[model samples]
Target: MGSGDGALNTPRWLRGIWVIPLAFLLVFLALPLVVLIIRTWSGDGWRILANASTWQITALATVQAVLSTVLSLAVGLPIAAVVSRYSFRGRALAQALVTVPFVMPTVVVALAFRSLLGSALPQGFLIVVLAHAYVNLAVVVRIVGSQWSQHDDRYARVAQTLGATPLTVFRTVTLPYLRSSIISSSVVVFIFSFTSLGIIVLLGDSSTRTLESQILRRTSVLLDFPAAAALAVLQLIVICIVIALGAVASRKRGQQKPVRNALLSMPTNRASRTAIHLIAVCSCAIVLLPVFALLIASVRSNSGLTTQWWTSINAIDSGTTRIGSPVASLAQSLQFALITGIVASLVGGCAALAVLAHRWGRFIALFAIIPLGISAATLGLGMLLAFGRPPVDLRASGLLIPLAHSLVAVPLVVAVIAPALRGIDPRAREVAATLGARPTRAFFTAYGPTLRTVMLAAGGLACAVSLGEFGAASFLARTGAPTVPIQIVRLLSRPGEQSYGVAAVMSLILIALTLVLVLVVDRLGRRNGALRPAH
Candidate 1:
C-alpha cells in the first residue's frame, strides 16, 4: 500500500544548510553566552554563585516555568486542535490573534492582565501562569497545529472502527502522532516562561521570580554585574539543555507519513465541526479580551465613556513632572519603535543573508539568536555597564532603548526569515544562472521577490517587538522620556485611580498599534503568497 508519498530523506546539498544554522548557533547563539559564562565564572562570580538565595530563586523560577508550561499546553492544545483541524469563518484571523500576546511586550501584557485581573487575583503564581499561558498560546497553536492539520484523520477513524472509543482512539493513535510537536512546543514555552522578565517584574512577587528577573535585580537594583552575569549564564545553560531535549524528542523517527487535507474537511460530523468552530471563536475571544478591555478602559471613564483619556493625554502633565502625559510616551515609543524597526531589520536581514551567502553564515545567524537565551535585563545591564559610561554614554543619545530593542529583535528576525529562506527552491537559482543570468541577477531572479516579502513581514514583526518591549527599556529609557510600557508600569506602580485609568488608556493604544502591525504584515504576506506554514 506504500505509494511513496512520504517526504524524502534529507538530500546532500540541503544537508549543508545545517552547517550554516550550526554556525549561527555558535556565533550569535553561543558566544555572548560563553562571554556571560566566563564573566560569571570568574573571580567574584563564585561568591554570588555560592549565595543560597540565588539557588532558591532558581528553584522557584523552575517551578514557575513548569506550571506556566503546563497551563499553556492545557489551554493552547484545545485551541490548536480546533483551529488547525477545522475550517470556519474568521479562522485565519483567529489564528493570527493567538499570536498577539506572544509578540506584545511582556510589560504591556502584564499591565493589561493587571488591569483585567490584578484587582481580583493580584500578583503571584496564578496570575503569572495565566499571563504566561496567554503569551505562549501561539507557540503551541502554530507549532502543534501545523502538525495536527497534516495528521491523517483516517488513522483515527480506523482506530475507532476497531472497537475503540473516541478517547481510546485519541490516546492510542492521535496523541502519539502529536507527541513530537507537543514536546517541541512545550520546550519553547518553558524557555519563554523561564526567562520571563517584564511580566514577572510588573505583575509578580517573590513567588513568581525568574532567573531573568533576578538577573535584572542583581544588575540594576543591586548593581552586582558579576552576579547578574552569572545568573544569565546559568539561565543560558538550562535553556540549551531544554532545547537539546526538544531537538532529540522532535527528530523524525518512525513517524507516520503526513496526510495533507483541505482545512475544511477534517472534522468528523456537523456537531464536531460546530464544536470546533465555537472553540476557535472562543479562543480568539480569549486572546483578544484583555486587549479589548484595554481599548475600553482607554475610552471609558467616570464621565460616562468619555475620550478624556485620549484627549487629555497631553494635558495630563501640563504643569507637573509627576506623571508625564501618556501621549508623550506614545510618541516616544513610536520613535523608538521606528528606529528599532530599521536597525533590527537591517542587522537581522544581513544576518539572514549571511546564512545564505557563506558556508559559515549559520554561525552568524546563531549568534543573533543568543539574545533570546540572555535575559533582557542582563542584556540591558551589560549594555549599560559597557556603554552607559563616561566615554560612551549612549543613554544621552536616546539610542539606548532602540539599540536594546534591536538586540532583542534581531533573534526574531532571524527566526522569521531563515525558515522562510529555507523553503525557497534553490533549483530556481541554478536555472536562472544556467540561462546566463549573472550571479547576483540569478540570485535575485530566483529568491529576490520572496526575500522582499519575508523581509517586510520580519521588519513589521521586529517593529511590533520593539513597541512591546519593556525589560530593556526599564534599564535604558531616559528618566523623563519613558516609553509607553515603561510609563504604564510607572503609572501602575503609583497609587491612584487616575493613574490606573491612564495606564489602561496607554495599554489600549499599544493593543491597537500591535494589531495594526500584525494585520499589515499578514496582509503583505498573503499578497505575496508567503503565508504558508514553515517546514
Candidate 2:
C-alpha cells in the first residue's frame, strides 16, 4: 500500500497539527533546560560537577535503583503471570488494584508507608527501597504482563513434554522470551527510583539521598542555583545513559516464529488452581494493605473513631499550619485537572495526528516523550528558572501548574492515541473521499469517532496525572493555593494527630479521584470500541 492509499495524503491543514505540539514542547520543555544550562554555566556549575559528593550520590542512587528494580521484579512477576495468563475471578479487579499504588501520588505512597511501617521499619535505605518497589509495581506488571499474555504457553508445554522441570523451563524458555520486556520495565522502574523526589524526601535519610533530592535541596534550601543546575545536568546524563542501555538491551536478535492467539483459561489441576488463586489474593492484599491503613488512620484518633477529619476538610483551621484547607486544595486540583486535560488532549492529539500526516511525524512522536525521561524535579527546577522570574513570570497567572502537568501528560496521551489512530484503516478515508468528500472531511469521517473516544480517555488520564503530580507542583504551586498532593505533603511534614488525620483524609480523597478518573477512561474507551485486543 502506498502512502496515499494506506496512509492519507497529507493535507496542508492536517500537517499543521504538528505546529502546536512543536511550539508547546519548544516553549515548555526545551527552553527551560536551555536556560538552566546557560544559567548554570555562567556560574560555578562545572565546579560542583567535579565535587566528590556529586559522583558519590550518583553511585549510591544507581545502586539503590538497581535494588529497587530487583525487588519490584521479584514481587511483580508472579502477580503478572497469574493475572495475565489465567482467567480467574476478579482478575480485572486484581489488575486494577495493582495499578492503584502506581497512580497514587508519590507523597501519599510515602505517607502510607510511614503510617503502615514507620514504627516497624526505620526511615532509611531499606524503607526507601521498599517504597520504590511499591510505587513501581505497575510498571512491571503492565509492561511484562502485556507481553506475557501474548506468549504462547505451547513452548512451555513442549519443553515440559521433553522432561524439563518447570523452573528449568522458565529459566531457559520463558525467561528468554520475556527478556526484552523485563529489561525495559526494569530500566523504567530504575529511572523512577533513581530520580525519586517525594518518596526519598519523606522516607530517605542521608544514606538514601538521590540526586533528585539533592537538586531540590540545592535549589530551594541552600539558594545555590549553580549547584542545583550541575546536579540536574549530571542526573540528566545518567538518565540518558540508562535509557540508551535499555534500548540496546531490548533490541531483538532474530525474527521469531509467530504464535497463535492463546486465550486465558483456569488451571485444571487442584494444586495449580489453588496456587494461582492464592497469588491473586495475596497480590490484592499486598496492594490494599497500606491503603487500608491510611483509611483507618483517617478515622481513628486518640479518643475514638470519628468523622471529624472528613467533616473538617473545608475548615480553614484544619490543624495544618503552613498548608491551606483541604477543600481549597481539592478545588485547585480539579481546576488544574480540567486545564491539563484540555491542553494535553489538544497538543497530544495533534502530535498523534502528525505521526500520520507529516513526513517527520514519527520523530515528533519520539520527541514528545522526552519528558518521561526527564525527572519531575528537573522539569520543575527548569521551569522555575525559565518562567518563575520577571521576564516571563507564570507563577501569578495560575497556568504554570497546569502547563507542567500537560507536559507530563502529553506523552501518555500520545501513547494511548497513536496506536488507536494507527489501528484505524486508512482505506476508510479513501472510501469517504471516493464519495466526493474533501480530504479533511474524509479524514474526520474515518477517524473522528476513534479520535473523540481516545481523546476523552487520554484527557481523563491526564486529569488523573494532574491530581497525583507533586514534584513540579511543589516548585510551582502558589503558597495560598496548594494542590491536594502538595497539601498532603505539607500536612505530613508537621507533627500532630489532627495533622496526620487531615492528611490521611486528603490522601483518601485523592485516591478516590484518581481511581474514578482511570475507571471512567477505561469505560469510555471500551464503550467507544477504541480498545482493541493485543496481538
The TM-scores of all predictions, comma-separated, are 0.87, 0.96
lDDT (C-alpha, whole model) for all candidates: 0.76, 0.88
Best candidate (score: lDDT)? 2
lDDT (tens digit, per residue) of candidate 2 on 1-535: 1234444444668867788899999999999999889988899988988888888888999999999999999999999999888887799899888988888889899989988998899999999999999999989999998888888888889999999999999998889888998999999999999999889888899989899999888887898998898889889999999999999988997523435445468878999999999999999998998999899889989999999888888894545555668898899999999999999999998998888887777778888989998999889999999999898999999999999999999999998899899989988888888898888888899999999899989999999999999888888888788999888878877888888999898998999999898888888878766553111
Off by over 4 Å in 2: 1-10, 255-261, 316-322, 532-535
Return the top candidate by TM-score: 2
**Least well predicted 10-residue stretch by lDDT in candidate 2:** 1-10
lDDT, candidate 1, 143-247, per-residue tens:
999999999877887998899998999899988999999998899889889888878978888888888888777866898878888777777778888889889
Mind sharing the TM-score for model 2?
0.96
How does residue 516 of candidate 2 score in lDDT? Answer: 94
| lDDT at residue 484 of model 2 (Cα atoms) | 90
TM-score of 1: 0.87
Q: For model 1, what is the alpha-carbon lDDT of residue 533?
A: 22
Native-to-model Cα distance after best TM-score fit, residue 230 in candidate 1, in Å? 2.1
